[model samples]
Target: MKVVNKGLRAVAVLEACKGVVSLLVGFGLHVLAGHNMRQFAENIVSRLHLNPAGHLPSIFIHSASSLTDARMGLLAIGALVYSLIRLVEAYGLWNGLVWTEWFALLSGAIYLPFEIYEMIFHTSLLGVGAFLINIMIVGYMAHSLFSQETTDNQI
Candidate 1:
């Protein structure tokens, strides 16, 4: 159906966007690995007018200060791997691959528990939005898979 194809394309675009963001983040981490992260955090807090002594700002600075080059490199590598998976899924979905529907459904569903935990505890608008969007994508993928199976059986 046209509607189903459109939904797949839309989700493919979303997956591609997520991949790009992760890729950018990996590149950023790579670039920042050898830099003065504490000073960078301080600069960010200063530019944002956040009190350096404040709890969140202080934690940010401390966390940044504690980052080792090895740790940063490992995180960058993890982000790169995540980006690659997402991009591949996006490509498969764009091509209407059945395997990609299953992949998307499983991947999206895997985050549901974590998202629900975040919504229950942190309760941020961004967290809620991510949860809703992920759930919708998972549901759509499931529906698409089931419809395909039914069509195949009827044929």
Candidate 2:
């Protein structure tokens, strides 16, 4: 790949690594929470099921629905999808792929504020690093893209 692309690739790899780590940790937590939630819901529903109070059926139905709905499962799946997409964009960034870079630029720019907010509200080492890294990469990529366009216009 070209030197520019090589630099992009480096950035992309870093982003991908970050995404993978976050997704795995999130997934683990989701699973643990899901397990506990299901158990609690089941226990409550079972007791309600045994009681036959007029409202018991409604309670059991609601509790059963809550258990089976598995919002945690949906959250885990969403996180997986987002993580994969981010990694793909990172690959594009690493190789200095124009379209990939643009995608990364727009997406990164959008997320930058959220990251900043997170850092300001809840400071942490990783959050600070992520905020700074995203700002730098997005700025660099935006410049590279615009400059290339300007150069091409003169040609």
| Residue range with the least summed lDDT across 10 consecutive positions in model 1 | 1-10
TM-score of each: 0.96, 0.64
Residues 1-155 of candidate 1: C-alpha lDDT, one tens digit per residue: 22348899899999999999999999999999999999999999999999999999999999999999999999999999999999999998998887888999999999999999999999999999999999999999999999889988999
Off by over 4 Å in 2: 1-4, 26-34, 37-69, 119-124
Q: Which TM-score value belongs to model 1?
A: 0.96
Candidate maximizing TM-score: 1
Cα RMSD for candidate 1?
Answer: 1.9
Q: How many residue pairs clash in each candidate?
A: 0, 3
What lDDT does the true structure give each of the candidates? Answer: 0.94, 0.74
Query: Tens digit of lDDT per residue, candidate 2, span 1-155?
Result: 33565667677887798779769965864765536554565566667565434476557556544653356667677778888887888777766668887887888899888998999899999999888888998898788888888988999
Residue pairs that clash (backbone atoms under 3 angstroms), model 2: 8-93, 8-94, 9-94
Error of 1 at 129 (Å): 0.6
Strongest candidate by lDDT: 1
